[model samples]
Target chain A: MSRVGVVAIRRGIRVSIYLPIAELSVNMIILLAMGGAVGFLSGMFGVGGGFLITPLLIFYNIPPAVAVATGANQVIASSFSGALAHFKRGTVDIKLGMVLLAGGVAGSSVGVYVFALLRALGQLDLIVSLLYVVFLGTIGALMMWESIGALRKAGKGGSTTLKKPGQHNWVHRLPLKVRFRASKLFVSVIPVLGLGAFIGFLASIMGVGGGFIMVPAMIYLLKVPTNVVIGTSLFQIVFVAAFTTIVHASTNQTVDVVLAFLLMLGGVAGAQYGAKVGQRLRGEQLRALLAGLVLIVAIRLAVDLFVRPADVYSLAPGVL
Target chain B: MKRCARKHALAVIGMLLAVAVGGPSAFAQDQGEPPRETINIGLSTEVVAITPDFSGADLTIFGSLENPDPQILRQGRYDIIVVLEGPLRPVVVRRKDRIFGLWINVDSETFSSVPVSYSVAMTRAPQDITDAKSYKQLSLGIDNIHLRPAGENADPSKTEEFGLALRSLKQRSGLYNERVGSLTFIGSNLFRASLALPANVPVGTHRARAFLFRNGSFIDEASDQLMIVKSGTEASIYRAANTYGFFYGVFAVILAVITGWIGRIVFKRD
Candidate 1:
């Protein structure tokens, strides 16, 4: 009997579902729970959950290629759902989003090309794990430090309002200035487009919606108004992630639709309850908790990279 | 003297039975010098459909031997080996090396044609049935399957290493398997062989071959083809993904959009 069959027989339940592209059987309940848990975290922190979901799937033993591609596909659902709410609230800056998308499209195309090259070279898995470790480690540490500082300040009876530093920065001095009326800011289109392109490249390579990086880049570097930051980021992410999904599907044929659909089903439903719970928690505490979680995942991936694998030899289809 | 008489009586009874069932051919063969032995195998189904919940299954192949010498058959010198080989496909085997404190795939070797799966069932242990040279010549066992390296001028040592790795990996994955003593003779000339088909059996045209041997010397062989195919919606989805990838991708996006839209409508919180 196959391993899945043995497991099914042992458990006395019929919860395993076959993934077409991945060509494997996985427990449905486990996938659903994973999606729901990541969705809960995303809703709680107001961040796109792609960063979390991709690694989680990898930890669950899904092939890196399938996980990365399917993660991008799953991101579309949550981003679209979030963007709709922002659109209704009139917080999305259409002009700004459009400019960002132009750069995002170009960057995503190049990223897909590189992705295919690495896969053929058999370096894709290593590169994906390394990138995840670096990004998650840095972001998690920074979030942890910042949240801890905030918590300490609150404990000392001080106002915890986040300080907005000098409005003019090196980013503001770049050429090709443009005005975004909704954001109420005049900024160089060069920095805006560059940032978007950078995030788009990461989105394709890392299988993330790029919100974790994009949100901070917008707030600190571009100095976009806080209200419009998330809305505009989601608007751009919805398009970039969508493009990444299509390109990956066409180029790599790695996207598992069954896997993506399962994740979306659990994610959308879990987000509602997560949002409710999020409202009750303090922002600093939530940030600190999320940071810890991110660091743990990063550490786990890093350990795998350092530790010896069970088998040094592996097989793949097709001739080199 | 009594034992010899009983043996003669049994052989006569066997000869009469063969003549009665094996027809005029048996009579002609009996009149002539001992006839050459032949083997014939039959599969109940030509196409094996794999459903969504398909697990591994045992495939039984029935065969019969013609004009077998009763004395050799009673002595158990006759042995049969049956093999079910999946379609051949190109494969690459990669070896990982530690570089900069990380395990990374540094070298790979490719084979032009390798069976996706190989399942063997033999009357006895491989070593007991035939010599290593004979097995290699016939390519009868898992280790003996010829794995041709893809490119020319490949290092012989490396090719051998990769070939070994390929066989070991396939065996570990249950795709290449062996079942000794699974081929059993029910009558003097009738036998049955059972081969295990893995759950992840590649969907393709597989060849089931039965080899007949007398006293460890090759006599005859027969083969039949069986098609293993994915049935129902799963097969359609697999075909769509490979054939119309772009449209499939668009459909995936549309499905996601609909699911998200439904989620928002069903659980409206904002």
Candidate 2:
């Protein structure tokens, strides 16, 4: 059961939970509900909940700056748990994850600087929202289309062959080749590093763990085994999120620990329950559901961009 | 929790009672002195401590309209406007313009000094109480608040519209409020108003100003101060997060890791 009894009401229609960095009180129930919903989806789909949580936080009237930074803080917890589970299963490629982590940390630093510049220019909200619409829209559509194709293939009783990774791909032709025994792939470290850096850049600016993006990129592009992709992505995400948290905390002062803690209270439990529920669903069905959810969020964001806002002007503290 | 909240309420009431009983006699003691314009005010609490359990507070402002001429009192032409204004801070107001079929922030205005929260209670509607010139001079209403832009680039004439937009936004957020005839009279000379400080009220020293008007003319104004501060664990955490950000971030990471580990143990699956 949810800890509904813990909620303390301030006034009519308000159950306030003070966010330290945001320096405001938000509805406790709403924050927890959002966290739980995203956490459940993360556990069921093996995607970091940040992609959903950050957008939902924005919808709840949290400042985009605060939402992105604090979302990174919260992702640390979820990714840590997910990573540990994969570690215990012996699916995590620790060396590859470390290399990705190194690249991710460097990339996040540059991303944080870029985020600061956009914020200074008062374009952070526009950029973040636009990024969400483009990336989420493209990724969701692709996932849905691919999963539908797989489902159709299964329906026709045809055997599907995954083209052997690293065989004739441009990724293998690059210099500085390294062998990863766990995924049984021999690939250039340059592409892996470049991929990690790109995902890290997106993760920092978009307030997502970049797991959904990273998982697909690793499997199809880097040719990492399906079993190892989730674990390695989680491993890299943990460090990237932690690094992003510190950078944001030190620079932007937007990491609201109080809010993050409250979110985790619901997220941790919801993830466990969701994992249990996930055991009953097939892989294609899970992918379909996740893709549908992503598309829905993307469309919602797109509609917001097109629709006229009731108030054309907004106020944030401090001079531009 | 119920008992704790009641205790706080009782404490506030006791303070108000002390002020009510002790205030008049002190001022009346100087009987031979010439009468002068004076306003005496007392708050239910001078300081609001926002601990982790603090949701918000309903603050009471009680005061007396002292030394008004007996003739004016008899004429019953006095109006009172009580305003509580939060600390001034810079604010950015952005306007979205349609660009290529999508709304984007094309124009922006920055106000160097604007109250984070402002609430006003008047004895009657502002328009009925005074003329527009006096209202602007006194900043009596939400629309009349003078929030000037930081830089001179913004056109002066467009500021009114921008100010109105800011007011609407703040009003929707429950940070700005205006109430007509909300103040009640305890007697002919004493009046009190209660303001509900929303949970999101900006933490700072707030000014509670009361203005007196008679026959559509400004009479006298008195102002008092109230401080809202974070206390207990909330304060400590907030302090750490701001003062020692990098360490706090690391601590946050450790906390998350520990919680995640414990969650894994508790929810262990074969």
- For every model shown, what is its TM-score relative to the native structure? 0.95, 0.86
lDDT for position A49 in model 1: 96
lDDT of 2 at B14: 33
Question: What pairs collide in candidate 2?
Answer: none
Residue runs of model 2 more than 4 Å from their true location after superposition: A1-16, A22-30, A160-163, A179-185, B1-34, B50-58, B232-236
Candidate 2 lDDT by residue in tens digits, B140-259: 778888888888687886776677788898887767988788876676578897776755677899999998887778878899999988787667878888899899888888877887
Task: Give one clash count per candidate, in the order shown.
Answer: 0, 0
The DockQ of each candidate is 0.69, 0.40
- Please report how far candidate 1 places residue A234 from its true position, in Å: 1.0
Query: Model 2: per-residue lDDT, tens digit, A96-196?
Result: 99888888988899999999889877789889999999989999998898778777787898654443555467777899998888888788899888888
Worst lDDT run of 10 residues, candidate 1 chain A, spans: A1-10
Best by lDDT: 1
How good is the docking of model 2, as DockQ?
Answer: 0.40
Where does candidate 2 chain B have its weakest 10-residue lDDT segment?
B28-37
